[model samples]
Target: MAEPSTARTLTTEPRRTPPAPRSVGAYPLLAWTWMRAMAQYPVSLLLLTFGQAASTGLELTALFFVFGHAHQLAGFGINEALLIYGLAGVAFCLADFFMGSVERLGEHVRKGSFDTMLVRPVSPLVQLATDEFSPRRLGKVVPAVAALCYALAVLDIDWTPARILMLPVLIVSSIVICCCVWTLGASIQFFIADAREVANSVTYGGQAMTEYPLAIYGRSVVRTATFVVPLAFASWQPALFLLDRPDPTGLPEWLRYAAPGVALLMSLAATLAWRTGLRHYRSTGS
Candidate 1:
């Protein structure tokens, strides 16, 4: 009787189910934390943001001046080129502002600080991106957004409801492309120990290439960028849609909508590569 009663009591006690994993919110939770932290470090952030703004503004101004005189390259005008540059600018800076700090993976691994990241409940990549928020690079975003807005106003955008809808979609595609490139560079750090130069080339090269008509480039370069690096969809293809110019590259019109999808796929691939690399992660000293 005593044993039966004890067994019943034990069986009646509620079993604690493990907490369900929280859904990743619409805005990356880590990105929100970074925005808050940047708010806290106001002065340093402002100075950096302003400095970046000044430098980038000068570069864009120079580009405008040079291209303005010529008026066209490979059947593209100054305004059209600026549109491409402006969009690419926002993409690159957002990636830097959000996850730029993570580009220092080699240093973190070398110093053995990566282990500290491993112990956390959240992802190391998320933690890494949030670790340092540069308030200054945010200066770049304002001008880029302004340029985009102004360009849309000044240029004939053929603003149908569908085209209008695609505007925000284009910006997101740009962001994904930039972040994917950055993430890919960071992933290489897991293997090469110090992939800084190669990383810079990949990130900066894509940005530089997107500033002009990709059509002028040779087939070999174009193929390498298309299948290998994937800079084509981010700027080249979408620019065709924006300029109302038919894609001379023979890519379909419907493909413009696919840019964001391609970007998402690339980002997912980079993430999977990151996870696989993490499994083989040998902290620098070991």
Candidate 2:
């Protein structure tokens, strides 16, 4: 009793609240996440990068050899051909680097992971795409851009402000075109549940188309690619503007300037197709 009376009351401190989590921008965060995750596998990263460089270099060499024996193909000379090819390579590399995982959307949807995405606060498409950023694909980009720069220097084409501006237009337009083709490919998963090879036909096949002048292919094939898929707008058409070649398709000179526009249209169509496919997605029972 005497001890309790003598004791002074102790003051207690209140607990501090934790800080709120910081929100991150989608693109930068996605890129960082990809870089960090990819860095974890140093050996695999190096192998992919070097492998892409070698394969592309070899392919270009073959094209050089072919054109060395012949004057030109479809009005483009060897050096001009390389310039176009290199530009396409850069476009492909950049597209594949960022949007490569679009190829895997089928599997994600089939596995019900797409459903999991619907519950998140972030935009499903953006989050899913960000989660899949692949720097390993940059393996192709480094050499492709390097080759493009080299090709530009070696080639005799006159440089104009308009031509210089076309470079970025070509890259962004190609990305949109590829994304559209990929969405079309992904839509098959809704019906077949597994149509990877067929989808790849567009992804890989589209990339293949970029390696040559559109005129090398038969008129029928070119028409199908241009009107049906609009792949030609990404590389072939804009290329005409850069090379100062006349449009044999009777398409106006301004049409080449519409590469980004065509790409946007294709992308919208692909999105509509995707929405149609999503409604058709039948998730397996848990």
Candidate 3:
């Protein structure tokens, strides 16, 4: 009792919880900084943008020439085919512009600089993407949007309430699919070390394929593309649904509405692959 009275009570201050993790601000700020950096080289940026736009324009030109002769692909006339191509362009532009770094992940891995992203508070993926954001890539949007507008002007859709709402949703789903495909490509780097060429084959080729009717491909090819890679879900079926066109490949009509779900699943798969790859990654000393 005497000893207890003699000892002064020691009070410990309650620990304050760390401030809530902030993800919302990090990416926007990082993206702004990166955009500023791109602004430093006005002419070079202009040239890079022009180059991208020109290349994509040539792609659309090729499609025009093909349709000019064939006049139709599967059941898709030039107007409908152009609709698919235009939406696909918009989808690819959104993905490539926002997440251009997905292709160069191997280089980052080789340099071991990707490790730096792991120590940050925000998501490594978001950080990587924002760090690599290219403002110049937005130039491609001009041609893509132009194509989409041309399609809209030419095609006569039912344009019901659901279709109106689905337009933005379709656009978003397209972006998600394209981005996930790019992420999948980056994930492959963990296994192959340098698979940019392979990844490009899938993403760029898949993108090109999406611009046309899948019915044009062989049966086996269409089956693989639908069930395996599923790139067709990005824009083709959505275009069919939004424009009230029929699917010549005989997929269920309801499948058109499944674009958002497919996009989510692909995104989850890509994320899982990225985490798996991250665990397997061996940092190079350089």
Candidate 4:
């Protein structure tokens, strides 16, 4: 009995380590989560999407009406103008789809909900941008894509290898520049809580401005957009190159290829602004 008692000992399993936290896939995961939530009510999503598509269609109709009356706008024919509109629309839609929700930063800051994002493992920018992700925004892309495809099909251009490559490059650069502008706008909210309208003026206003030939605007306005705001690179400059048209504003033809460089610089500035804003952020004390 004593020997049996001495032999009575318990054995346990080895302890397992916990998994590592996510570094990547955080944005898509959060965006997908909100998307799934929205998908629960398919009818509402469809209606909202339809509304978006309809609104975009109306804008295109207005463009057609304008073209019907005037065969050319600012020296650009119907197809050329449509190319500009389509390029601007696609770029703006993509930026808005990805980063538009960042505009609500002011609301989050005011409600003190932004503090919650700081405690999470994911990036605050990623969290904010992916918040309330909706598929309705994608509906706007349909008309834009249709316009682009139609323009590309009808527009008679000498498509070179370089020109063909520049098409995607211009689109990508425009998207990046728009995204940077959105980030810069969001960063401004860190200082001024009511800057949403001002930010929208830049983002939305820039989209509207780029949808047509820059030649329609005054030289001062065109220069401001080109050198100061760099919005010209979004559509006008690249479209000039694509159409083999000269700059009515007297800007150098080489500026057409400068979109990528401008986009890189804008990216740097936006990143710096965002980091500075984050460092200066104060909790709402909720």
lDDT of 3 by residue, 1-286 (tens): 3587657876799989888768778878999988889889889888998988888888889988998899877878887887888888888888988776778888877777788877788877777778757777887777778888898887887888998899889889989988999999988998898899999998889988888888889677766777788788767788889767667777778888888898989989999999999899888866
> How do the residues 161-207 of candidate 2 rate in per-residue lDDT, one tens digit apiece?
87887878777887778767766887777777778788887777777
Candidate 3: which stretches are off by over 4 Å?
A: 1-20
lDDT of each: 0.76, 0.74, 0.83, 0.90
Looking at model 3, report the run of 10 residues with the lowest lDDT sum. Answer: 1-10
Weakest ten-residue segment in model 1 by summed lDDT: 18-27
Better of 2 and 4 by lDDT: 4
List where candidate 2 sits over 4 angstroms from the true fold. 1-24, 249-251
Model 1 misplaced stretches (Cα beyond 4 Å): 1-42, 249-252
Q: Compare the candidates by TM-score and give the number of the best one.
A: 4
Residue pairs of candidate 4 with colliding backbone atoms: none
Worst 10 residues of 2 by lDDT: 18-27
Model 3 scores a C-alpha lDDT of 0.83
lDDT of 1 by residue, 166-199 (tens): 8778878878877888888988899998896799
Cα deviation of 178, candidate 2, in Å: 2.0
Which predicted model would earn the best lDDT? 4
Candidate order, lDDT descending:
4, 3, 1, 2
